[model samples]
Target: MAPTAHSAVIAALRAVGVAPDAYGPTLNTAQSPRDVDVVGEGLAGEIRAVAAPAALVVWDTSDEAVLAHVVARNLDIGVLRAFEVEGLLRVSPDVPAGAPVALLATQWGERRLAGLRTLVANRGGQTVAVAAALTSPALAAVTDVPTAALASSDEVTGVPS
Candidate 1:
């Protein structure tokens, strides 16, 4: 089974105790280089915990290093682009189990969970990703990322990749 979106990598980062103030631009979108700095810091710690491969889904190309940091820390990473609910849904079903993923987006707060769940389930076991809201409010607001953006496995597997 694959990791779910609830326990996604970013959520796990929070679960492990990384300060929000040290992780991003705001809490919505990851636009500031400062936000990436925070994410990289927290991600460094996360990478040390897991022994398996992981992936990251980012909304911007600017986030490659953030993803690379995770990979360098020892986790695997994949990149996704978008903060919209539907965009995440389109990319979720492909996360591999034991391979947590990270989601980097702008501040959306608690307005998006349905999409997170759908994406998280793609991993099968539990969600695994480090999510960074590249904007403000500095907290997930909710326990998990949004799931509203996810689509069925059949719909996502064939995506461009």
Candidate 2:
């Protein structure tokens, strides 16, 4: 089964060897309710910011939950320089992809042209391939890399150009 947000958050905390109870009060944001607004969004932001190649530890099993907890909590204790599995895998030039190639597409048919370049750069400066729900002239400007038409943003998952 897919992990719930609570499970994911708990796992993130434990990854860093933190006691689950140590997390301060969960905040409620002006946005959605289920969006369990952690008081220090900065904590999550820091973890994600340093995670190059966009180390995305998507918890498919219980194992990842453990890993997530460690990452989440340990990162908050101090500015740790240790590498997580995702962090290592993301930056390792030896990986088959050399650099990860991301597919940027929008489900809502918004203009992807402006955002694609920045998203790719932000995500470990990886090569970007643009996919769009509908074709647009702006996408044509992205010539140095590959571009394609995707049925929806969801299709971009794990799809390399």
Stretches > 4 Å off in candidate 1:
1-42, 46-53, 60-76, 80-88, 105-108, 122-125, 133-161
Cα-based lDDT for every prediction: 0.39, 0.31
Put down candidate 2 lDDT per residue, 24-73, tens digits, no spaces. 11112223322222312322443333332222222122322333333334
Error of 2 at 4 (Å): 39
Q: Give the Å shift of residue 31 in candidate 2.
A: 24
For 1-161, candidate 1 gives per-residue lDDT tens digits of: 12453224344333223223311222322444344344454444443443233555543333343444443443434544334454334443355565555554433343343354455565453554434322223233434533211112222223342
Worst 10-residue lDDT window, candidate 2:
18-27
Evaluated against the true structure, the overall lDDT of model 2 is 0.31
